[model samples]
Target chain A: MMVVISYDVSTETADGKKRLRKVAKACESHAQRVQNSVFEADLDYSSFMKLKGELLKIMNKDTDSMRFYYLGNHWQRKVEHFGIKKGYNPEGTIIV
Target chain B: MMVVISYDVSTETADGKKRLRKVAKACESHAQRVQNSVFEADLDYSSFMKLKGELLKIMNKDTDSMRFYYLGNHWQRKVEHFGIKKGYNPEGTIIV
Candidate 1:
């Protein structure tokens, strides 16, 4: 699976640098620097959940924000009926 | 190469219908209807070029516009130095 994650955070937190460090370190395996503060990479489903969970936990209590852009194959919009499969043909995928 | 194409035209063109028709038809083989005017598909590089060329030619003389989002593997940012190989491992790619 290949993933692309681009994120930016408000620079208002006293621990802004610390938070960013935690984020980078936590997602080290699934990401590499893209832009100065943005990172991108690939990971499986379990890694995805773990990364997201870690991000949520690592953020400053209530003063920080984040956004993720999952790019490449193996990426899909979450759906209740059809979650995810190990692999699927990616011809003509309509993404919302 | 998987492609995700979402296009919205400027509504003021009188030939909007014709232009859209051309675009839809040009990309018909590489795409399938996703939203009312949006489409998604997979196509090799040669096919993608043909579709783009057709769209450019069929568009109103000076009344419309278009954009393309090439998605998934085989889809890549144009780079002069690293050109493109038929296939490449897509993990940890640092796309610009």
Candidate 2:
């Protein structure tokens, strides 16, 4: 399954800033950053659950917001993109 | 159908800034702003098509990136959110 995770963490204070970095780093470990606060992850059912649990722990329940879009296996057919940044295939080869 | 539209418009130039406001306004006309550049809209097929056309015209293909997610009628079941900002029901009451 492919999951799209988007989050907004409050950066009004030093604590909020630290949480923001922690959340971003956690997502980066499991997925590729498509935008500043968005990530695309290719994971199995168990992995997705684990990732979600980890993120929930890092985010504040009162000030941060997180959304998970379960794109299923046919996510490619479900997404449409336009403009400068092209859509990336999570399964495709990366030269770098 | 319900649509989630997200965009990132380059603001490196004065013209880009203008386009950014245009894009945001276009989206604001049809949906609720859920984030700086994200919107949630409840529209029929024709309305969705018209909104897409209008946004494409406002955006600069060379510098802006837009994504449209078709959540279908069952979007309520397909989305999960966590934290401060509660999800607004697009079809529910809005009392000003």
Candidate 3:
């Protein structure tokens, strides 16, 4: 199970650039630098937890000016590849 | 079905900024700008084709420094929502 994190940040921090680089460094090889404030990474459960720990340490928690998203697991690609099969009540909740 | 395009550019062009702007304009509302050279868009099949057409017109076919990617459909959210169920031989091709 891998996780992808997307953070929407309002570029208002005095050290936002430094913080962003720190986050990128944590990504190592499981990441693809997508946009300025977005990064795509393939991380397992443990890695996801590790990333969360790292992110929270540098996040600006005093305001809602920043948001974080967690896209969990590689299985998402499968779901994208094949949605719920017909006659399966595709709208029902599914396991990751 | 919407598609997401990721293009990597070498940043060496007389009018790279112009071309990039044109591409961003084509995105309209379904796109999110990420970095200097990356963008993410939720696009349908037809829209993908339209984007392909637009991109090709500005592409420098002579260079190998650029690349494009396509992530298709809104069902992606489902895939991202839930991966293949267990015991389903999840590796087989999916219906998208």
Candidate 4:
């Protein structure tokens, strides 16, 4: 399955900034950054559950929010992007 | 059609901040703000095109990027949200 994870962590305090970095790092480990706070990844059922659990622990309920869009396995057809930066396929190979 | 619009505006400079506000305003006019930088809306083809064009004009190509996720009309099942804040249906009626 392919999931699109987008989050907003309140950065009003030092703790909030730390949480934001942790959350971003967690997402980056499992997916590719699609935007500043949005990521795209293709994972199995177990990996997806683990990723979700990790993120849930990092974000504050009172000041932070996250959304997961289940793009399924055919997300390429569902997304339309506009800008100079183009998105990379979640299933594609990268040399880097 | 249902569209999910998300953006990342570079806010390093005064001009970038201004552009960010403008881009956000453009999105809010047509959609419900789902997160800090994400929005969801149900719009017709012409309306979607107009909104996209307006946003494109406001965002800088070199410093900003935007994405539109076409969830068709059955977006209710495609989205999975997490956190304290709950999501409202784009098709639902709002008294305010």
**Candidate 2, after superposition: displacement of residue B51 in Å?**
0.6
TM values, all candidates: 0.37, 0.76, 0.49, 0.82
Give lDDT: candidate 3, residue A35: 38
Better of 2 and 3 by lDDT: 2
Cα displacement (angstroms), candidate 4, residue B67, comes to: 1.3
* Candidate 3 lDDT over residue span A6-92, tens digit each: 443334574654566665666545565543444555666676667667767765554212223344443355222111121111121
Tens digit per residue, CA lDDT, model 4, A1-96: 888888876565888778767776776668887776778778998998998999899988776788888877777898987775644333321222
lDDT leader: 4
Pick by lDDT: 1 or 4, better one? 4
Clashing pairs in 4: none
Q: What local lDDT does model 2 show for residue A39? A: 72
Which number leads on DockQ? Answer: 2
The TM-score of the first chain in every model comes to 0.61, 0.77, 0.57, 0.80
lDDT of 1 by residue, A1-96 (tens): 544443333334557656766777776666654333444456777787677778777765344435444454644441011111111112211122
- All candidates: DockQ: 0.03, 0.65, 0.03, 0.64
Instruction: Write one digit per residue (lDDT tens) for candidate 4, span B4-63.
Output: 888876565888768766766776668777776688878999998998899889888776
Which portions of model 3 show Cα errors greater than 4 Å? Answer: A2-14, A29-38, A59-96, B7-14, B29-40, B59-96
Candidate 2 residues lying further than 4 Å off, grouped into runs, are: A10-20, A86-96, B10-20, B86-96
